[model samples]
Target: METVKEFAGMAAGTLFFILLTWALTSSYLEEYDLTSAKPATASVAAKVGTKSLLRPPAFFVKIRQDDGSPSEELHRISRSQMEKLSIGDPVSGYATGPTGFSTIRTIVYDSIFYMIGIFIFGFISLCCLFATILSIPAIDQAEQRSSHKRAVKKKRERRKKKKKPKRTRSGWGLALGCVAFFLLVTLPFLSNLVHSALPAGKNSAEALIINEDSYVTYRKHEDSSYRFNIVFDDEDGETILAIKDVTPNTYRNYSIGDSLPIEYQTSNPYNIHVRGTTLTDIQQMLLTWEMFLYAALFAVSGFVIWAYVNSRKNGRRDSRKGDRFASR
Candidate 1:
């Protein structure tokens, strides 16, 4: 049983620490929401609004005309366009046939989801914090019971005309000090909680290239997975390309610079088109931080349980040894 005075003091002190920590963390959360993986604020510089380069299904060459000839005009002639368009063909309007999601919608939806997640995580933090705080009283109670038992032993020793005992548990000062120490240990862990998301876009000035290099890559390298940079526009700008084997012997490739097939965003640009396939999944920094934090939490919890069990065992062992020596 805890003295009312001690219990009230401890309870008040613990709540104070929790509120202080929550305030500091909330401020930092706001900052994180502003800067990192923000869909609304983050955007690619260029956009692939209405135009996409059509790669030829077959080799297509231009018809040559010398003077005022309709056939001799300079035009981008892909194999698909050749059946309908002749030389000097002036194609009008956006390429509509590509099927995919819109960047603007994805960005908006992602931002909303992010806001929801932050709110939910804040609640979870409170729950974990409550668990930590509640553990304090149980820790205090265990110490107190051990102290009371030691007192009984001392009284019995005095009856036997033995020397007075020095001390066992430190005192109430130690108990109060432990509340502070718990704060010192667990407060910093709040930093590990995190959330992040990325958006890629086409006008995003990224590179997509397929040539002899890719052909040689598949032929030379065996089936070990790899992450490497590939040249986008003119080999000067390099964006990350993910190469994965979706099928048994076929490689799926992705350039990080482009958005999904269709759609536009007013605020964000870096939104990339994502498919059901895991071909383009890339790890973000926030996720790694969260992983480390959770790992640390587990480690500390294990240590706490270990310390409690070890302390009880040692207390019992010392009591038995003291009794043996007194008998002698």
Candidate 2:
């Protein structure tokens, strides 16, 4: 009766996992199809205007008709597309909708991130399914052992052994060590992987250097350290403010009211990058491949360690059984 209950619980858990995986997969497929659709080319003549001042700021285009009259409808745009436009610059791209209300799809709005979600859920579901299947044999073996009185006595004897406690502690220690190692090695790569997937600064624009300052920190028996910072704002009257750390030479080179060439991330205007600092397409591809390689190595190393530890434990158990039989 207990075994039946255990099986039922496992079935329920496996079904839940499978359902979650299916939902995520379906959503991902739908998004993939939307993004894969061929975009239409259309001439867009509109004046750019800010729609919202929120984070990940939104913009809209006041469409101008061919007869020089403004259309009633406004088309929304992303930050990357908006950055290149002044209050009234012509916007043109592969449009995603009808002529007067077309939107240009940019990297910020892509569905690539859904791939990561689907992959994670699918992996979890597969692991749950395999675990449930493997546990059936273990449950049967446990039931058979429980039916024998001598097996119960032997189990009690094994539990009382001091070596069993030490072995368990060692196993737990190894597991913790492996987990720590895996996180230490993979966390940086994972961070880079996610960052690479997101939209970065693509267009360069000059920001007015509003202020510059230097601070000094003195240490005992050491020369005072100087930190230079500059504050800048973009030209769109959008009030994009960013403070950047600069070297002594760079700080001295630019003064207040100077135009500083800079690039800011589309998703976050405050996260500024120096001009020409963004990764190229090939470099981004290499970074993704490197992350995958590190993940594969960690998985292989963990499997090898687990297999070695299990073999050692099995050998010890077999030697103990042989000693008991010889004595009898």
How accurate locally, in lDDT, is each candidate? 0.38, 0.56
Query: What stretches of model 2 exceed 4 Å from their correct place?
Result: 27-32, 39-123, 138-328
Among these predicted structures, which one has the highest lDDT?
2
Error of 2 at 205 (Å): 19
- Candidate 2 least-lDDT 10 residues: 48-57
Tens digit per residue, CA lDDT, model 1, 1-328: 4555665665665566566556655765453333333222211221121111111011122232334333311223232443344334444321212311122333343356455555566665576556555557777678677677877888887765433222324542364355456545554343212101223222334333232113223433233332222223312332322221122122244334433222112122212222332423322222233335545655766666576578779879999999999999
TM-score of each: 0.21, 0.31
lDDT of 2 at 19: 90
**Tens-digit lDDT track of model 2 for 1-112:** 7766776777788889789878876876554444444554333455333211111224555556667676655566665665675544666544433442345543234544
lDDT of 1 at 222: 37
- Give me the displacement of residue 189 in model 1, in angstroms: 16
Top-TM-score candidate index: 2
